[model samples]
Target: MTRTDGRLQVALVALCAAVFLDSMDLSLMGVALPAIGRDLSLPESTLQWLMSGYAVAYGGFLLLGGRIADLFGRRRVFLLSLAGATGYTAGLIASGLLTEISWRLVFFLPVPIALLVLAAAPLVLPRGVRPPGAREGFDAVGAVAVTGGVLLLVFALTEKSWPAGVVAVLLLGAFVVIERRRSAPLVPLEVFRSGTVGAANLAALAWACATIGWQFVAVLYLQQVLDYTPLTTGLGIVPMGLAIVITANLAGRLISRYGLGRVAAAGMLIQGAGILLFLRAGATGDYLTVLLPALVVHGIGNGLSFPSLNIAAVAGLPDERQGLASGLVTSAVQIGAGIGVAVLASMMTLGGSTLAGYRIAFLMAGGFSLIGALAAAFGLRPRRPAPVPAPTV
Candidate 1:
């Protein structure tokens, strides 16, 4: 391969690996939460906060992070995040193996990794030729408003606080006003004018809500209802992860052939079907009969839909705005996951029986997936841009 090809390949691998590690870090807590709670002697409420707090922090600053990436450089921000995530993962693994570790270790483990990434980033990533005027200052007020607004919203959902939600709405409204007045907004409002970007973000939000909510239910069913060990529970979900990895690559090619909107809609429909299948699960149902098939189907849908939505979101964006586009997509995923966990988990407890609650939660999640499918089909319908004419001499 040529030098340019080699650099591109490296960049692709690094970025993909970063995303993979980030996802794993986020998800590792699901199956392990009970174990962590027991070891730390924590209440269920505290455990809940630990899980939701990560999503809040991640989602809240994502737009700001993107703006920072655009201002400083994408490579720098990515390397920093990746390194911190890696260290955090390592610390978690260590805590698992060792006995009687302090719970605070879990929260502070990423600090060392952040420092290491700070030192090593220049050597690991390629130095690109900076775009002209790339170092423009960011909109600090707009950034603060949006970040605070998203955090409050996420916190309200997680904690079920109506007053916080109202405050969040006000803050977000202020963000819009500030962005309009700013010389250079953190996120250029014009990007939302593109149907593709808007639809992709909406679809991503719905997909995350459904899938994360389903997974939360599945974990509870496996451990609490079925009485499986945590290790066994983790092992049982391996096939779903493998299916996602395999199908995601295949979906990229399918997008090249069928277009983004069609593939995304199909994926969502398939995922909804998977969740609908879970309605058959009962207190006495076996994993093989009730859960495995749903897991496989859901995995396939995730693999197909997520990549297509991502491609669609960034399809028409200029190079300089790519970081912002990516951040928006990532933010949607985090926020949706937070909302899903809060809403669906509550549904699971409000019904007559555990089995009944599970069924209701599954139905709601499935409905969200179907809604996403409809949105993808109609809202993201592709409109190829007209070509600019050749310039006259």
Candidate 2:
């Protein structure tokens, strides 16, 4: 391959490394939560903040991130973001192994990785490509409103703070008004005009809500209820990860043949079924009989659904708006994930972390997937071809 092609590939790796940091942290933190809680003497509600805080920050800034990339430069923003992604990729297993050492070490593990990524980013990522709207003013008001609004909303739901909830609502409402008035809005209000974009974003939100919350609970179930060690808890989830990797290879082909809507719908239905299967999990639940099958089923569904949702979210949009579409969908996923974890955490505490509470959380997660399925199946339907005029006419 040419030097240019090689550099481009390396740049892709750097970009993907940052993204892996985003998704992997969710699971890694889940594995560490029980240990973190035990060490800190924290409750379920508080333990969840570790996960939700990162998710909310990631979600809230995504739109602003895209806008920054456009205004500054993609490579510059990527390098800046890569600094944050820097951490040990070994967090999955390391979170377990390190938590044994000290739960604090788990948080420290990523520092070296970030430094390495930072050192390499300047070398790998290309420079000099500026977006058309580089001169446009930043939407500072919209950014603050959305970010603060989501933060407060998640805080309210998790902590049961009514006053915070009220402020969150007001801030979010103001965000809509602010965006509408801006000449170059953080997110253009017109993107939602397309049926596919709207539905696909909704589906993406629900999918993240169900899966992230379920993942959080699954780790707790294994470590807390089933009495597995942090290391064993980390290892136990391997089957699902394998299933996702295997199924994701096939998901691309399925989307190409069946289209985004059908594939997403089918995937979500399978995911819902998988979560519902956990309804049978008990205090004395058997790993082989109960958790293993559900994990694999859920993983396969997750693999299929994840990629399609992003594609559907951007479908039918003009080339210029593709970045905005991507940002919007990712924001939906992250925000939904934060809210889902908060909701499930509340459910678990309601039953005092008993098997009944776990069951309720799983049921609610399943319901989220079902909502995703409906959005994908109906909302993402392909538009009909416009009729051609007769030759005579």
Candidate 3:
């Protein structure tokens, strides 16, 4: 690895910080879903779309975001993205359109803007720029295939009229055929061939869907089942925020010392256990017992594993391909969380009280996490080969 000058180091840190904030912002809504849904008179089915909508918008455009970022510069796009994301998130908080509100604003607005800024960030240092053909990257066919598969999975969870899942699957199958023949792909054909970064990313996506999606369902449980107010539901998730803050730094260090594979697996497994606790929740369950404990465990799980996944996703890429790798890894996370919340939310029914629906969601989260664990165990190796360093973008 080459040494970074002060400006490059600052830029990296700034972008990473923005990523953390964006990540938190995305999950924060899940914590309020129950209260928000009840207040808005939304059905569980409708709630599912709220999550899914953001995901579709984000996933659909990820490739373009990365490509643009590579052309523009990472720093510039990163800052602009931050501005747009902050603005749009505020819009979601303030908007009163109800279901008519566009989820696209919620998801697509920020990252793409960030990518644009990121693509432009390299202006600070002349050395940061790289010539084209330094290495081949961006597997277009792979991008289509992955996108199709993801969208299909998301569609399968939806009860919408469009049957988007079927289309997604067909598109994905076709994408697979395309990738086999294409030379420069969006997702390198070789990356998918490896169990480590590729599979870990997949597991990260699944785990994210389960863990991050919980806020929506759990919040609903608090308000609908326990009769907590919106403010209170927000407060309920506050503990999760605190836990993340406290543990993320520690998790980073643990990954440094113990390696990401074993540590991330443990974090995910523990989170799965936390979801099981939610399954045991009842209408009359105490708040401290049922809610706080589960969130603590879940939060710890998230804190421990997240950074590792981020690092893993771009581990072996050549220097110039960093932007693509970063974009793909992040796209997977947002898309996964979006789909998980959407699909699981669709499963919610009024057949039982808030407690009942929440239980099912938690179980679903656990299943996702378990799948992540298996994928991580088999695919994600912590001993990353030296990175193919990114251009300034």
Candidate 4:
């Protein structure tokens, strides 16, 4: 591979790892919440904030992070964010909330603070100290919408049903309006304008939403319904991670040959299939026969689609527009995640039991994935690269 290609590959891998660990860390803490509550003297009222804080912090600043990278330097911003998060973690540990600070330290500090660094790193590296691009500017608006929606969602989270949902819808509509009107909009109008690109991104949003939703449901299924310990739950889900690694390599080679439409359609199909399988899993089903295989398929689908979707979404954009392209993709991902969680939260409230909630979530995931599959199959028709301008004779 060429040097630049090598860097992107290496960087993408690292970025994936960082994002993975960040996600796992937040999940891990949820797994450990019972222990934390027992030891820290945390008030029942404030306990959920650990997860909420991270969500808020990560979602809140992602666009700002992208903008900073666009205007300043990505490498520099990443380095600083890394340093800042490290320091934040240290301070968080030292604060000793169990003795004094309590939920305030545990919930509001380390998790989000660390993520602020993690979120900033990707944006900074891609854009750097240069023009962020018209599309990027557009995506920044999308970023704000994403952040506002998250905040409103979180603020309204742990509350009654209708009120939270209403707030979420309103904020989402406001965000969409802002995105449409902004000159250098947060997400490029063109992204949505291009049928292939638009379809890919919207499909990505659905897939991501379903991905996060299912993962959330799966963990709850293992822990709350089946009464598995946190470690056991983590072990059960480990196969999916392994599957993603193996499948992504295979998908990379397949994409240039098959086209993004076929690959993405396959991804959505696999994702929907996985969720369908999970929905059928009873409180007493065997993990190996049901959950394991489903996860493996789901992981492969995600791995195949993730990188290729990025490639397709940004195809044919000018170099100046690269940052905007990246931002749009990033914003879509974050917004999808937050929306998924909110939707699942609503389902859980309606169902009451962990299993019932999980069933509802899996169903939603399956439906969304199917929609994504349909979009991929029908919406994308690949275009040949535009002819280059001729050199002067």
Ranking of all predicted structures according to TM-score, beginning with the best and ending with the worst: 2, 1, 3, 4
Output candidate 3 Cα RMSD: 7.3
Residue 328 Cα positional deviation in candidate 3, in Å, after optimal superposition = 1.8
Q: Ranking by lDDT, best first? A: 2, 1, 3, 4
For model 3, state the Cα shift of residue 314 in Å.
1.7
lDDT of 4 at 224: 56
Name the runs in model 4 displaced over 4 angstroms.
Answer: 1-53, 96-129, 132-146, 153-185, 351-354, 384-393
Per-residue lDDT for 1-393 in model 1, tens only?
898787667656655555654575557767777667777787544555555567756875787888778777777677776666667666765765476554434444444544554555555577665555456677777767776777777668656799999999999999998878877787788999988888888898898889887777778777777887887988888878888889997997898899888999999999888889888777776788777898889889988998888888877588888888988888888877776776677677657987888888899899889878987998778786799999999
Better lDDT candidate (1, 4): 1
Residues 1-393, candidate 2: write the lDDT tens digits.
Answer: 999898888777766666676676677788889988998899988888888888888888898887777677777887777654553344544666644766656555556656666776788877867777878877877988998999899999988899999999999999999999999889878888899999999999899889999988878988888899989887878998998889988998999899999999999999989899888888877889988899889999999998899888877687666667778899999989998998888888666548888988898999999999999999988899999988994
Model 1: residues with Cα > 4 Å off, grouped in runs = 1-7, 40-46, 83-124, 132-135, 384-393
| Top lDDT hit | 2
Angstrom error of the Cα, residue 284, model 2: value is 1.7
Instruction: Compute the lDDT of residue 194 as modeled in candidate 2.
Output: 91
Residue 93, candidate 4: alpha-carbon lDDT = 65
How much is 358 displaced in model 3, in angstroms? 2.4
Q: Candidate 2: misplaced stretches above 4 Å?
A: 84-101, 351-353, 391-393
- Report the lDDT tens digits of candidate 3 across residue range 131-233: 4643654455566566667666676666663577677777877776776676665544676655566876787788778776766677667777778876676
TM-score of 4: 0.75
**Ten-residue stretch with the least lDDT total in model 3:** 102-111
lDDT of 4 by residue, 240-275 (tens): 878878888888778878988888788778878877
Best by TM-score: 2
TM-score of each: 0.86, 0.92, 0.78, 0.75
